[model samples]
Target: MIYVVKNGDTLEGISRQTGIPVWKIVYDNQLSDRNVLVPGQALLLLGQGETGEVSGGRAAGGYAYPFIEPEILGQAFPPLRELLVFSYGFTFEGNLIPPPQDDLWMVETAWNNGAEPFMVLTPFSGGAFNNQLVKVLVGHEEIQENLIRQMLAAVQDRGYAGVDIDFEYVLPQDRAGYAGFVGKVRRAMNEHGYRVSVAVAPKVSDSQRGLLVEGIDYAALGENADTVFLMTYEWGYTYGPPMAVAPLDKVRQVVEYAVARIPPEKLVLGIPNYGYDWALPYERGITRARTVGNVEAVEIAAQYGAVIEYAPIAQSPWYTYRQNGMEHVVWFEDVRSIEAKWGLVKEFRLSGAWYWNLMRPFRANWLLLS
Candidate 1:
């Protein structure tokens, strides 16, 4: 079970209330300051009936087949078990559509490399999430059923291990409908011996408001799906201000919330294999960040004679450099950051960690996973 810390709650208080030891709480959550407790912070409480013991070893997984190159896949596929192709989309009428025809070869390659290939389904059009498409599909019961039927057929025909539902920009009004859709899919897939997983936004509370977190009902979805991948990266994004993609503190909050509602074994934390380089003097909508590989970000720093600094709180590496009289900031993951994320998996005893992509070359990350 997970307990949300209240404003005046202490570790000892939570321990007593849940009949769990304070040390267990401190250790499970990796709390450095036991005295300081933030409201909305999730605390894992052991001995709960539904919440079983954390498994000894977690699976290693990643999203591949889109940005990933053939050469990179040859090297990176060995350490991964679950490989979600990115991805197939849906039309407004709930008709299934395939990704680029070229992706089929990558899917075959992943299967040949001993990775479990999962077809990713999304509500995207023209390379962006289409909110209207989700509303239509979830709102109509007949359409939902048709979509799931097609998905099961597709998964079975392609010899896929499962289907990963990556529906984004879902409207809050369709919350119950979305959960219902997942339940329907889970039943259909389980009957056919296929897996059902969902990719959800990083949310710290059920009441957390926003288009990203609103439609996802974590408790309900956890009960229906085989696994749920928390898209924990992108706190610092292409158009947003420069910061760590998945800050340790923010990631911790999300994990805490998720484990409280969903079982730890069914949770997969998301890790980013890429980073961002932003020009300074960021304007809300004007300044844009360029996406860069983790390794490339470091080379950029060295090229500009910039000093790389690590943010202890975020557990991410960043550096500032000047070019053409303009200051720029680059924040990215390194071996140190990857290790910290993997440590979270061990501490929380989660199902495992999955990279947002296998597109870029991050040798250190692969070595760590191996």
Candidate 2:
């Protein structure tokens, strides 16, 4: 589990509470020094082992491994199927590069755990859409076909059970183009008996408009994909004013509209295993936010001798502390909040929940689900 850095929390203290070694904690989290942590930053505790050993809550030889680290492998192994969705990126040459070793491990871990695994093809470059991928799909039609074929073959050959398309920030005019590309990927993968999933923006209504939400054709995506993973996080983000990651009010609106045209069983609500701590007196493009995990929040509370307080409305936890005369606010996930989200999954009869990342280890979450 992630241990957020607090004013008084020490590595030795956290290690004692978790029964993990202090050195392990330092190495697992990539700490350069023994006593330095950002209040809102998250650290992966488990080792970065092969898939099943890390994120896939898989049990091998009758032992289920603990996902103690967000990006590393903690325990030996376990036997449980974890539903995983990977966001794939392309190479500078516009070719569908294989995922890194860590990804393969994650995939293997998921499969070993009895969980179905899918990859969400996306474009990435310094946090923006990769210009190379966009050029091939938008500018080079011939290369697109080859890339699609290669992707289908690779997924099947690599033993993946499904694929999830995660194309974001597409030009509005390319809505039809995006739809057509998805159809092609689906058809190709289906012939090989692979399931197809797509990630979409959470739209409050069919008429929702904007670069972020407008291009997504929910109806078409619902029809083409076996399941649509609704991106319900980031409503409260670093760049924006503080808010709930998946606010109850906003999520209900998105879900109500989506269910109007999409089947519940084919929908999977997205839940964030992380949170953001924005600087107070937020200024436009001036105050950057820090991302954090649940366990860390507790440590932060402990560090400042700050008591953890819960928000009834958001169903989340927060803590207040002072550092160098600067007041701070921290909001993050906890077992309680995660359980609340799971309630929504059941209430909506969603196929399942998808995590934005399986990079951080949250023991509470595993315990709740397992």
The regions of model 1 sitting more than 4 angstroms off are 1-57
Clashing pairs in 1: none
Per-model TM-score on C-alpha atoms: 0.83, 0.76
In order, the Cα lDDT scores of the candidates are 0.81, 0.64
Candidate 2 regions exceeding 4 Å error are: 1-85, 91-94, 100-102, 130-141
Model 2 TM-score, all chains together: 0.76
Over 165-280, each residue of candidate 2 has an lDDT whose tens digit, in order, gives 78877766677667777777888888888878788888887676777776788888788777787887788888877666766667767777888889998887777767777667
Q: What are the C-alpha RMSDs, in order, of all predicted structures?
A: 12.5, 7.7
Q: Cα miss at 169, model 1 (Å)?
A: 1.4
Candidate 2 local Cα displacement, residue 135, angstroms:
6.9
Q: CA lDDT of 249 in candidate 2? A: 62
